[model samples]
Each structure stands twice: as structure tokens, then as C-alpha cells.
Target: MEIGLVGKPNVGKSTFFSAATRLEVEMASYPFTTIDANKGVGYIRNRCPHQDLEVECEPNNAPCINGTRMIPVKIIDVAGLVPEAHKGKGLGNQFLDDLRQASTLIHIVDASGSTNSEGEPCGKGEHDPRADVEFLTKEIDHWLKGILERNWDKVSRKLEVVGGNVEHAVYEQLSGLGVSEAMVVLAVRSADIQESPKNWSGDDLYRLAKAIRMKAKPMLISANKADLAGDDLMDSLMTLGDDIVIPTSAEYELALRKASESDIVEYMPGEDNFKVLRDDISDMQKSALDKIESHMKRYGGLGVQQTLEKAIYELLDMIVVYPVENEHSYTDKDGRILPDAHLLPRGSTAEDLAYAVHTDIGKGFIRAIDSRTDRVIGRDHELKDGDVIKIVSK
Candidate 1:
């Protein structure tokens, strides 16, 4: 699954991306510093199952770092969103299109309220972060709505005469956005607009649009630049949703990672604290590290990790499974132990994992063995998180 970093300009989306992926991108104080989307492999931290089995795991594709499985995922840093972007302003269409494949969005909000509506520098608390959250959601809705509306006449007219489903028509319109027909159907049903396709009003279309956007592009607000934010600013943002707001200091995360690279500090990607390896650091650098430490102590690790975890596991309901040829040794054909850990939907079955491993194995149509229990199981057996399965193909 892909997670897209989105927000107004200068809200540190690039910094967040750099910290999370360590991909060097141009970060500037002005708007639209990222003209195109930058994609890199980020990771989700999972407790490696090898620790429970009392064995040392030598993973190949997904590495285990100190008992934490680093499962790689695609992360995107996209161009900032401006008002009326759906109206083709400020490379808006390009930015929105960059998010076409994203499973979820991390809205990098300037929690300190430092940037204005146009992404220009402003007072620390002048901008309402609540507005920042809503504006991005609305912009995405507008973008989807525009796509649906542009083809409405042809689609609705065809649906009327051909007796085609409204959801399918809308889904086809938004096919480029990776929207599913089931998602569109649910969105239309949730909006409670029972009108026929040809009779759908602009408001009806918008309601459907909003619902589709909510389902297809669900977002979590990464309360970014939290170092400069006050209590009131945080409280107001918390009021938006208890679990949705993750206070993040992208700048601090970047600093910690950079320090780790420089051998001045020993750090883990998602650890709450770090070890200062050397005492020769300058006083200014020491002060900055202190502030970052304070942020970590308060918020529980750099929020970048938590944000990605939430997007994949919580929002997307994905679970990790180890598909090995030899379940006993947890090795692939080449004898690489725990070589592949595939992320599948929570309810995915053993056969689903077989398909994820190889199409030929899935088509062979055979049972699977659960390594944990060493029990023979059918294709329909639902796989759980950290399940190690050996497919018995024909």
C-alpha cells in the first residue's frame, strides 16, 4: 500500500518524506517546492515472529532490525495543495493525480498554524489547523467531483437507457483514481441519495463525491511542526478526532536521522529515545537535540512511524504473513529464512497468500500447512498476522 504526504506548501511534507524515506529532496520555505511527486520505500515496524520462535531470523526482502520487521512500503511526497486546485490552479490536477494510487493520505498539517490559506508565511497561531484539515479534504472531493461531473452527461444518459448501475457509471468515471465499484456503491448508499443516475442533482453528486473520497482516500492529520505549537493549538486539533491527529515533528525526525548517520547518536527509526554516542557535539546542536527529545518523550516516538503504521494496518486493515516454501525452517526455495513477508488484507485466506507468493502456486489448487501448528489446512483457512504458511501445491 502507498501512503501519500499531502498538505499546503511549506508544511514540511518533504521533510517528513526525507526523514521517513531518507530520500534527499529540495525543501524550501516557499510554496510548491515539490513540483512533482517523490516516491521512496518507507517501512512499517512489526514485531518479528522469530523472537517468539527462539530463532535468529535472516530475512531477505523484508529485514528484521532488532526484532522489528521492517516491511517496505511506498511513500509519496506530492506537490502542495492550493485552493481551487480542482479548478486547475497551481498544478492542482498534477498534485491530485499524484495521489491516484495512494491507499491513504497523511495530511501534514502545520499544527503551529504558521502558514496562511495560500501557503504563505503567517503568524504562528494565525491559521486554524482545523481549516487546513478540512480544506484538503474538500479539495480532494472537488477533484473527484470534477471528474464525475465532466462525464456525467454521457454516463448518466447511457445509464438511463441501458439500465446500467449508477455506481458502475460513477466508478468508471473515477477509474483513474483507483476507485472500486463496491466503494462507489457504498458511497452512493451512504449518502442516502436514492435518485436515479439521470436525476442526480449537483448536490447529490457532491454528496456521493464526498463519501467516495472519504472511503477511497481516507486521511489522517499529521500535526506537523509540533515544536512551535501551543497547548491550545493541539487541543483544538485533537477535538477534530481523538485517534486521527498524530503530532509529528518532521524536522526533528530528520535531525535525529541525520545525527544517526553522522555517528553522533545511536538511534532506531521508531524508537522514542536515542543514545548520544559522542560528547564533542556543539552546544547549539545539543540544544536542538534536547528539544527533539522533549517532543519524542511527549508524543511517543517520531510520529512518522506511527502515521505510516496507522495508514497501513488501521486504515487499510492489512496484516503481514510469511509465505515460505519450508514452513519448518521458514525458508524460501533458495533457503533464505523468512525471505518474503507479504502484507495482505486482514481477512485474507491461505489461498490468497499462495496467489501473493506466485500465480502458479495458487492455480495448482492444493492445501496449505500452518507452520506454527504444523497442521494441514485448506485454501479457505483465514491467515492471521505473522502466519507462516507452506503451500502444498499440486
Candidate 2:
């Protein structure tokens, strides 16, 4: 699944992207630093079977090799969203368009409330992160509304004939947004549409838009610049409810990674402390590096990893499944079972997995053997995490 990182400019979105993917991008403390979307593969680090087996292994059922351990998930960093984005303000249409392809959204907010409504640095502004959060959601909803409005005559006319099946009409309108047919079905079934379009209240429209938005709803707020946010900001953000708000210092993590690569300091991104590897570096520089490293480890990669994973699993309700032929020796397309992990949406059945492998296997119906338990099950069997399935097909 693909996830998009979105927020107002200079809220550390690029920094988060760079830290997560370890790819370099231009990051600045100003608006519109990223004019276009940047795409990269972010790997979810997990132990693979070959690593666990500690031997050269191969799988007869699926493609894999020896000692492969991690799988990659795509991440797209879109341009910043501004007020009136739905109305075509500040590259608004462009920003929203960039997100059309993403399955989930990670709304990265400046927890410290250091920026104004337009994403400008406000040294003395109140830390009301809720405004940014709520505003961004509304913008997206209205953006979709605008699309519907443009096609209202055709969509509304169709809805009149279909009656209660207005959901289908709505789905047709949203098909361009990259929403799948299954997702549209779910959204329609879950939405509450009125019998008469004119009778629909403002709240009714809002709810319909919300249902569509929830199909690609965002999760987790990366409370960036946490070290600078302090207790007042933390308490204020806690009041926003039980949403996973992870405190992070993207800037600090980026600095630490750069310093480590440059050999200026011996520090890791997720480690709390660092040993002074360079004796030639000044004491002030060492002190500065130590503080940043402390922030990185304490906040844990500035919540980049947690936020990305949380958004994928919680917002999108996805899971990681490993399809392998040999539980003892797993492998991939290249015959290397280097970390056997594939993130898929929950409720994925065996047939779905066969499709993931190849259409030929899925088309030719057959039984599957669960390597972990050696239990044979039909094609409809739902897969669990780390499942090694041997598809006995034609």
C-alpha cells in the first residue's frame, strides 16, 4: 500500500521523508519548499526466515533467496496544504491531486504550534494544532465536494433514478481518485444518504463527505519539534483525544544521521546517546551533537517510523503477511528469503495471496498447505502473519 505524507509547508514533512527513506531532498524552514511530490520506498525492518534459519535456504513454492530480511512500502511526500486549498489557493488543487493515488494519509503537524495558518513561522503564536488538523481534513472534504459539484448534474440525475443506491453514483464520481471498487462499495454501504437530494441537510452532506474521506482517512499525528514543544504544548495536544500523537524531532534526527554519515559524530538515529568519534571536533560541536542525538533516541527517529506504520495499519487497517513455501528456508523472486514480509490489507484470503504471487496460480484453483502447522486448507483460507503456504495448484 502507498501512503502520502501531507501537512502545511515547513512542518518537517520533507525531513520526515528523508529520515524514513534515508533519501536526500531539499528541506527548508519556509513555505513551498517542495513544489512537487517526492516518491521513495520506505522499508519496514523485520527479521526474515533465512536470517532466523541462519543458513542458505530456498523455497519451492514462492520466489525468494537466502538472507533477505526487509520489504519496502512506497511513501509519497506531497506539497503542503494551505487554507482554501479546495478553492485552488496555494497550489491547492495540485496538492490534493498528488494525494489522489495514496491509500492512506499521514498528517504531520507541528505539535509546538510554531506556525501560523498559512504555515508561516510564528514565533509567538498559540499552539493550537487542532486548527491545522481540522482545517486540512475540511480542505480535502471540500476538494472532493468540488469534484462532485462539477459533475453534480450527471451524478445527481443518476441518483434520482437509482434511488437509495446514490452510493453507486457517488462512487462513480470518486472513481478518478484511485479509490477501488471494493472500497467504494464499503463506503456506500456505510454512508447514510437521504432519499431526496433537496431534503438532505448540511450535516447529511458532511457525513457523506466524511464517509468518502474516511475511506482514505488519516491516522496518527507526528507531533514534530517535540523537544521544543515542552509540557504546555504536550498537555494541549493530549486534550485533542486518544489519537496516537507521537512526539518527534525530525530536524534532530536528520542532523544526527548527517553527522554520523559525515563521521562528525558516532551516533545512530534511534540511539539516545553517542560517543564522540572525532577528537578534532570542538567541545561546543560535541555538546550540540549530543543534545540532538539525545532528542532523536528519546523521541525515536522523530516518530517518523511509528507514524508511518501506525498510519498504514490503523488508518488503512493493513497487516504484514509472509508467503513462503518452506518454513525452514524461505525466499523471494530472486530465490532469497532475505526478510520475508509483505504488508497487505487485513482479511486477505489464500486466493488473494495467489493473485499476489501470480494470476496463473490464482486462476488454477487448488489446496494450500500451511507450512507452520502443516494444515491443508482450501483457496479461501485467510492468511495470518508469517504464514508459509505451499500452493498445490495445476
The Cα error of candidate 1 at residue 171, in Å, is: 1.4
C-alpha local distance difference test of each model: 0.84, 0.68
lDDT of 2 by residue, 1-394 (tens): 6778889987888988887665222222212223334887664443345554455544232223223333456778888999898888997877987888788788888888888889989873364877888888888888776765666666566667766565566667787687656666676557657456545545555666666787755556777878778677867776777667777777776776677677776653334566667789878877887687666665555566667667766777666666765544554445655324556668888788877777897888587777667788887788875566666668
Tens-place lDDT per residue, model 1, 1-394, is: 6789999899999999988885222222222223334987777888888887777776776767778787878888888998899888887977987889888999998999999988999989999988988788889988787788898988889887888667777888888787888888899889998777788888888888999988898888899888889989988887795448888889999999899888888888878999999999999989989988988998888788888888999988999998878878888899877766789999999999988888998899589999889999999999999888899998
TM-score computed on alpha carbons, candidate 2:
0.84
For the record, the alpha-carbon RMSD of candidate 1 to the native fold, in angstroms, is 4.6
Off by over 4 Å in 1: 23-37, 241-243
TM-score of each: 0.94, 0.84
10 residues in a row with least lDDT, candidate 1: 23-32
Give model 2 RMSD, 1 decimal. Answer: 5.6
In model 1, what is the error at residue 290, expressed in angstroms?
A: 1.4
